[model samples]
Structures are given as structure tokens and as C-alpha cells.
Target: FNKYQVTAKPFFATDSCISCGLCEKACPVHNIRVVDKPVWGEFCTSCLACYHVCPQQAVQYGKATRNKHQYFNPHQ
Candidate 1:
């Protein structure tokens, strides 16, 4: 919330990510990387595993999500 385009719209990755490499581990299809930075490779499955597992919620789908809902259910 600091000098990152003030608007109702949320701009993820507009801030510095901690780069913990959690997103890499969460990718089931291995279509992501966080070596120097977050990189997308090939056609993603849109699983959102990377998004849900992200500890800091840094991984995002543009303004498409607010990290509010999820599909993964450990109980199931």
C-alpha cells in the first residue's frame, strides 16, 4: 500500500516478494519458477495451487483474485 498505483484495483507483484520459493513447490505441472524472479513457462493448468499455497499470498492472477476463495480441501 505504498506508492503502488493508488486505485481500487489490486496490483499484485507491484511490491517486493520475499522469494521463498514456495510457489515453485506448489506447482503440480512444474510450470513455474522463482530463481531470479517468478517466471511462467508453457501453458499453465490454472490450478491455482501456487496461489493457494503461497504463504504471503504474493502469487496472483492479476486482479482476478483477492485470495478469498480456494478449491483445495484437505479434509476431502
Candidate 2:
């Protein structure tokens, strides 16, 4: 079930991304690196922390999430 519930799919950042380190910092496993953009490592637990923590909402995981709603809960 980990494959469905969690994935290591590479995240794509749009032009709106500010290259901030929030996504990197948000990753509990340290699976993200921000060079000019975010680079995901295989250690991703698919927590989606990088996606929700983004202030620009610029993080996307393939076409499946293109139109999907992004939910961010600080309490998580």
C-alpha cells in the first residue's frame, strides 16, 4: 500500500517557484535539495510536505496532480 499511499515521484516546480528552502526543510527525511529548483531524492516518504509547505504552490507530482487540489495543514 506504500506505493499507492506514498511515492517517490519526482516533483516539478513551476516558474513561480522562488527556490526557497522551505520544501527542503519541510522534508522530514531530507529528501529534497534546492539548487535552482527542488530535486527529490529516493528517500521520499511521500509525506507531501514539500508540496503543502510551498508558499507559491509551485510543486507538482506529474499530470495526475495537475488539476488536483493541494491541501496544506500546518498542524500536520
Q: lDDT tens digits, residues 1-76, model 1? A: 3334323223234244678887778778887778765676654666677777766677677768764765566873
Worst 10 residues of 1 by lDDT: 5-14
Write candidate 2's Cα lDDT for 1-76 as tens digits.
8767566675789899999989999899998999999999877887788887888888887775676777777676
lDDT of 2: 0.83
TM per candidate = 0.65, 0.78
* Cα TM-score of candidate 1: 0.65
